[model samples]
Target chain A: MHEGSITSQIVENVLREAEKRKAKRVLEVHLEIGKLMFLNPEQVHFWYQMLTKNTILEGSQLLIEEKPGTVKCPKCGYEGDFQYVDDPALHMPMPTLNCPKCDGTVKIVSGKDCFIKTVKMLI
Target chain B: MKINDVVKAEEGEIFDIELDENILKANAELAQQNRELLRKQGVKAIDVMGSIGAGKTSLIEKMVQKLKTHYRIAVFKGDLTTTIDAEIIGKHGVNVVAINTGKECHLDANLVQKALRRLDLEATDLLFIENVGNLICPAEFPLGSEKRIVVISVTEGPYMVVKHPFIFMDADVAVINKIDLAEAMGVDIAKLQNDVKKINPKTKTVTTNCRTGKGVDQVIAALNL
Candidate 1:
């Protein structure tokens, strides 16, 4: 799983940044995950908690910003944004990944990255 | 206080990503270590990327047969369902493990690393990653592969090259399949070759008919087999 690999990198980065700021304890950690990344957030959180057991980031709550998938319509060439969610009442599918404008195959452009945007630590 | 959905007057510039510093640093470090591991083992990986039914599997089978005679090869098959391809290659007497991605669109580096564990790296020479049959997601994830080969078929139309040039852009080699029926099917090799060249000036495109094993020698020569 990429989560294991991504988790390790997150730990490494946190430690590096912690050393830079000369902080002994980390307060909270925040991460923004894109919907179109094809990355599993639960797996990421699971691995992050497991990997950060005794590290500086241990016990820190992970703030996950859930971002939706955005697609570009090649027909109308309109890159409109939409959330890929399920409508239980409407009986719609989860991955309704189509262009709303011209009803063409949607090409994904943005929303695929794993990074640490902010960190709070006790100085 | 009550609030309603906020509306903006202007469209926002693309964020490029939902940037997460933790995940980015973690992924980068893991990838860095992965690169080192590949280097230490001298594990040269090649990814075969193409659209569905572009004869990707046929070319892979041919190459594996040729390479198996000389090199200790292994395969990391990424398919949405069924390990049939992996099973077939394993019969050829090389280590082949399939990564069945139930719904995911692509195979990332993290997934590749897990598959590599089952393969004996010391005994392996050519590690081939038969990526999920698609032009998009496969191009995004770099599974620490040394090379990427984009396989295109003439039946699909030469225009596919122009539409998805990034596949060629991320590739070190390009293979066009189903060339035996080129004339019969009214598919022009010249136009296809030109379309490929327009996207990548350096991508080596070779026409092949996997059914007859025609024009596959160039691939062998290119890989120094």
Candidate 2:
């Protein structure tokens, strides 16, 4: 899963930051995941636990915050949250890129980021 | 352990560290490196992404058959386990590198960088990176290619476009492969093209029947190669 790769990166980043601060161990990690990203928070947390074993972040708490998808229409200056088409039968939700105001193509404004917001460490 | 009389022993203190950094920064940086290296070698690399039975391998074969005489071509076939697609491309007398990603759902920049090391970039003019047979994951990972092509066959049904607009948004060219089967399958080719346009207006759409090599030339032209 891609979450494994992403978790490895997160671990690396946290360890590096902890080392820079001369910390004894990591206490917590904060992550911000955009809605547009295909990452599942549960999968991320699972992989993070598995990857942090025997490392400075072993007992650290992983906190994740999800960012909503937002888009803006250039033609009509329409800016708001993206509408997703959800059907229980299809078992898939697709985001609509068309603008509701002018029915024009809307540009993605947010919800594509996957980044670490902060970290808590024991000094 | 208690040597200091003037100072008192204290437990370690916990502090908060702020690091607002993107997790994909490393991958994106590597992708930039690959892009520069390819550009320096004057190699035009195209990333091909599609479903398993969307005829991605066949379309690459058709392209190699048509352009092999005029240009030196190479291919990087990405799969979970088997080398079947790589073998098929190699049989066409072109250089092919099979990258077995094992359990990876999509090929990332690091994998492509490793594959590039094994290829003679100086001797090759065109490089085709056939991504793992999936639409969702590949859309998130860009392989430092000059053009990204997404192939969707008529057999994938009408909802393929609307269902997966993210891939089309990242694609530079969209190839509707196996168009010859549209009439037999009772699919609307025009409606498919319209759906693609609705999702991504800039993406150039081409209809092709790779079996007969029809529309392959147009695809090449669309890539401006």
Candidate 3:
């Protein structure tokens, strides 16, 4: 359901951009989803197909790229990627945020963003 | 000239447009607005998040019981499709707003902003937003609260802390509720607290039994309310 709302925002942005450029058709939409966002790309794509109907993005292709979760430790000065546990049966994976070097608490530096990076259109 | 030899070419251009905008930017901006508005109104807001049966409602009820006399309190209850929690809190004779998110798993900032608009902020000193019961989705969404609290009970199992560290990372305070049943469940109470401290050392950890009101005072002191 979160993906549905997010897809709506993406659609709105794409349509507004297309309208500004007077594009004949939207070809592709490039998105970057952070690992920590817990968003399922397949779900977003499924919702995009349904939400874009009759809009300028009706036939546009959606391409989603996942950004890995990165964290930096303030106490140990350790910076690295966090490990995510993926169970075959679970819908979402659990991310581990412990610092790899000192096992201290780390602050997330990346993998929280859900953004539209670019849009390809035929004008 | 032959008709076949007079063919013309069709021309088309492909253009790429960059839009480096976050899908959740709108929600974040609205959340900032809510935070600023709450600050201006002299209201302290807390976002309480946890899984189902984690004593979120019970802890809130206890907090309201303890703090209601000193400060005017208001609550915004968020659920997928029920007003049951709100009804329970409403019986305490305080302001309660029930927000049904339908199929959404978590409450967003926009929803909280609407609830804030409905409540008379001037009349309230403290506001508690009880987020939908789910550990995963709620951690990612900030509802513009001054402090974020994550409640987890021993009944849910011992692995909850390690399994859901992201929620602990986002929380300012972590409440391990239902400690009275820890011995019967064959689970340790201290190890769980240690797990939380390992993930977020800065997060204030409090053990509570909301039903009996044990350690609830520590929770208040930790929140500095």
Best by DockQ: 3
Better of 1 and 3 by TM-score: 3
Index of the highest-lDDT prediction: 2
Where does candidate 2 stray beyond 4 Å? A19-25, A49-60, A69-93, A96-110, B1-10
Model 1: CA > 4 A from native: A1-123, B1-29
Better of 2 and 3 by TM-score: 3
**iRMS of candidate 3, one decimal?**
2.5
Clashing pairs in 3: none
TM-score of 2: 0.84
Interface RMSD of each: 12.9, 2.0, 2.5
Cα distance off (Å), candidate 2, residue A114: 1.1
Candidate 1 RMSD computed on C-alpha atoms after optimal superposition onto the true structure: 12.6
Q: After superposition, how far is residue B32 of candidate 3 from its true place, in Å?
A: 0.1
Q: How good is the docking of model 2, as DockQ?
A: 0.55
In terms of docking quality, how is candidate 3 classified?
A: medium
lDDT string for model 3 (B110-178, tens) is: 999999989999999999999999998888788889999999999998889877777888888999999
TM-score for the B chain of model 3: 0.94
Per-model TM-score versus the true fold = 0.61, 0.84, 0.86
Docking quality (DockQ) of candidate 1: 0.13
